[model samples]
Target: MSEPWTLHPDRALPADPATRDLAREIYAATKDLPLVSMHGHVPVEWFAQDTSFGDPAQLFVVPDHYLTRMLVSQGETLPRLGVGSTADEAVETDPREIWRRFCAGWKHFRGTPTRYWLEHELVEIFGVTQRPSAETADAIYDQVAARIAEPDFRPRALLDRFRIEVIATTDPAWATLDDHAKLAADGYGERVLPTFRPDPLLHPDRPTWREDLERLAAASGVDVSSYDGYLEALRTQRERFVAAGARATDHGHLFADTTPLDDAEARRVFDAALAGTVTAAEAQAFSGHMLFQMAAMSAEDGLVMQLHPGVLRDHASAPFAAFGPDKGYDIPVVTEFTRSLRPVLDAFGHHPRFRMIAFTVDEDVYSRELAPLAGVYPALRLGAPWWFLDAPDAMRRFREAATETAGFSNMSGFVDDTRAFCSIPARHDLARRVDAGYLARLVAEHRLDLDEALDTAVDLAYRLPLAAYERR
Candidate 1:
């Protein structure tokens, strides 16, 4: 056994004395609040099955894209990292060896947020004092493996231990949600909910667009060969998700472009897409049109809409082909929200019932575009910094940039959009500490009252994310 390791106070703040002291004070106030994860990609199977996790590597390394992507970047095959479609693949099987490999390469993540979260997981969750290294790999692996075998280390058990009040997992519109159904039946209803992400069904540029459309039609009991039928089918899926306790719908698009095409043009584009002949421009236009229609439907159904746009997904073709989407090859690109969102903003920006949370990979937009748009539009609110931007520096930068244009009220609070269940607490803890650091600076400068800063800290930690995603 090793001596206990603990996170240093002011772990994520600048080294400057004033900011570091303020950050420490702020962190102390909000570190224990209940976590409310508004959006994430964790499969619901773990909670549904309620099975004991197998090993340290299988539990942490295999399911984390961040870990796998880092290893792959250094010419390490993902299969050797225990990432494969099925368990039958021949690769390194010993959990200790895998941990050793990861530990050997741990220096690759030294300055990254992954290092921060992994350290938290190691010290706080696994009770390891020494940093992960080749010398400590076997002992660390054994300890984590032993801890996971405990009855209280299961997914639901960890949820309670982590103090997660609500965790929303993203699900595609075409999904049957049988896993969520099983969870609800097993009585984890209040803790886990689904967010409907309708991208695959809307992106006509995808290779299996028509096939996915067919699947949607079959699943929703509608004939989706035509544009109107497709819209109806989407509405049916939304209704199913609503019945399953979904309060929001998420859209991941290359751009925030929105178009309100007339019925004739929409039908024409749908026919072309169905025939595998829609050009890139036409497909984009069609997707934009669907976005508007979806917003109108959201107005009627009361599901909050989330637009996470301007991500250049699958940028590295070879890795994407071999490993599939979300292999950490996604890159941020400049986005023009002001022009791209004109159509949707014109149609629904003033509607009180229509709520759209805007997220971006483009940090420049937080201050210049998204904040201003969200500030003025009654329907719009700024989502937390996402993906690559979820780090402590990005969170603080987002607050500094956007709070001037769109007050804290116009921005939804932090969300741990993570798949690693154990990392949930660590991610939220980082966000809270960073947020508190931000507020503490405001206090130190006398820009905000101590009482107000404290209240805002609590809201950022708990209330805001729940209110943003949970239907009003």
Candidate 2:
């Protein structure tokens, strides 16, 4: 049998011996920097409660769409992986069985970022010695379970172990933030922060729109019976997030269009939505207008605006119907930001307090649209490769394509946009290595001095995120 799982120290570095040496130095310098996670989807309750991380399957398999989607593509049912579409659905109940299924299909994740992160978690976090497979699954599961039983394995303790200086968890606009309040009272509010996410309230076409509006009204204590009242409720919720130490607002819309409708038009559309008579086209327009409003509000409030566009959430109906959203069905569609964002960009793109980071899964826009748009706009910067494109090769391509036009300063250092809490360090470590390799190539080519490359590497890994996520 092959040797037990081991990660090479030089993995993800440049291939050439000379360039690889330079990258090694850079990576060594950057590999241990304090983690500053400004944008992510980590569950807030983990740190708020500071509880044990449960079993191996629950930690690594159940909630990870990246793992489940690949297994699903290989013809394994989600239910067999313990991911039933609904609570009442008949599914695998044994965590060991789920672990076996994941381990047996381990080969399917070859060459993917999921493999890189999982291996890091297994080896570095859990002291796992064997590569996952049906044969080794039981042994590894026992090892991980023992580690989870340790007091140091709690979520808050892992934050210290992972060297995370600060992390922002995505929260709905109307969220009570009770968990966040708990963390704040425990004196970790600054380390574990909330991020305002108002996507649901902005999408009036959604089946749950009215229901979400009522929730917003109740949470914000603002009546949403009128269009102006709805706006006030959103603003009020944003203030609540700011009070909870939120540094940013996150939007994952399907389009980048941010054209503002006149107040009359906006009110008319909102009224139509309330009356249940809004057309699909009006709903889309209203969503775009809301984006404009979000940008405007960010300009006033100084919360960094994070815009992620061009995703068709839940592309497959069967799995979605069975397992619900974010079970790896979200797929990327073509996105254009240059023309689509002109309305908002023209207005706030130069505003001193307006700061925006544009993230897209569409690599085509890295050089053509986003880079140039961010290059000239004082308020805009290109975010790191996100979602489907956060892999090593995609990250390298992002630096290559966008750096020419936007340059390094205009890029938001690596934003680890993930929902998996344990994978945070792994994700950042991978980014640092990819960036070290990229900067090493530049140094070897005489395009940059080693000193300059080293400084830039630190910026990409540490300083840039602090600045990017800082209030402008």
Candidate 3:
């Protein structure tokens, strides 16, 4: 017989009875707070169209790299799991077969955050009552498919049901943002916003750099043939994003280096890159210089800057070649933020208009580097545990690591940073539980009073993200 499917009310609370009681109270105080998703990857078109999601496999499996990457690690191929190679390629056409594959590999998610989020989505969101396994897969899939077919299960309906006050979707710098404009015209602009991501145009070493530059130029109506023009084009695109209700700019670079280059040196590197004669070293230097320029732009424009560095994307070339990027090959690299960000910090760390939130896959930096920097810099706030470190234990560890130095106010509250729309509530709920448990322990230790802890819980769940992202 399959095990029963259930989510314990105190699933992530502390194990001890005294602390568990305290945690429950803390969680109850903030559990119903509206979600402020400042950073995420959900497509804006879904909200604009308000369409019903397809089958269970497409909704829960294919779009989520967190699930696909783990399944692939256990000898499952992407094509078999309904993931295509290119943008237009169709690999697995049968939803039932895809669901079967996922069910067969269900045991692999044990002790993983993906498992927790999946269970919450299945039980709480879709009202699934049966555990997922090879035997129960078809029945559960049918149940979820039936729910998805309902009008109440559509994107906008679910967003409203989830009580999401605001969500910001990651958008390419050169994107037309027509969907965003439509939503704004429809009067949902404040509810859903765009975040400008210039990763493609920042690194000239990437193969698609020239193409991305041309796209950016077209979007901005500026000629990006020279370095100055490139900067101007980027500025214009940011303004466009701001006009479309954007409040933040997202950067995902491989390193945290923020060294600035002189104008002549920057132009020289840009010219070499355009001429296809730029070396790897030159490319990295130029990228670092661009980080400084982005900070300068933020200082001028007041758009919050979000730096998510130290990820070596597409670690394996085979999967990247077979399937496009974000197939879950990104790996965390060692990062040094103290020195890497010094140049930019020196330039604009005290600027009243500039604000930056730094995210790191390198956990060592939380206490040693990030907390110290955020503690001192008025413009800097430490972003929550991101990507690989968003797990329950990792989040608790992050609090233990960073809180002593930076304190609660200096930290940006939990950011879902997910592409899975249905998983947003689950992710935020988990973060809240973890935080409540942490705060309960502090209260038990007499480090904080109960009233203060409650207030802090509310801030972490709702207020801080809005403030950090400047949503309000």
For each candidate, the alpha-carbon lDDT, in order, equals: 0.84, 0.92, 0.92
Prediction RMSDs, each to the true structure: 2.3, 1.3, 1.7
Candidate 3 local accuracy as lDDT? 0.92
Q: TM-score each candidate.
A: 0.95, 0.98, 0.98
Model 2 clashing residue pairs (backbone): 85-322, 85-323
Ranking by lDDT: 3, 2, 1
Predicted candidate 2 versus true structure: per-residue lDDT over 223-302, tens digit per residue: 99999999999999999998989999999999999989999999999999999999999999999999999999999989
**Can you tell me which runs of candidate 1 are displaced by over 4 Å?**
1-5, 14-21, 85-94
* TM-score order of candidates, top first: 2, 3, 1
Show the lowest summed lDDT stretch of 10 residues, model 3: 84-93
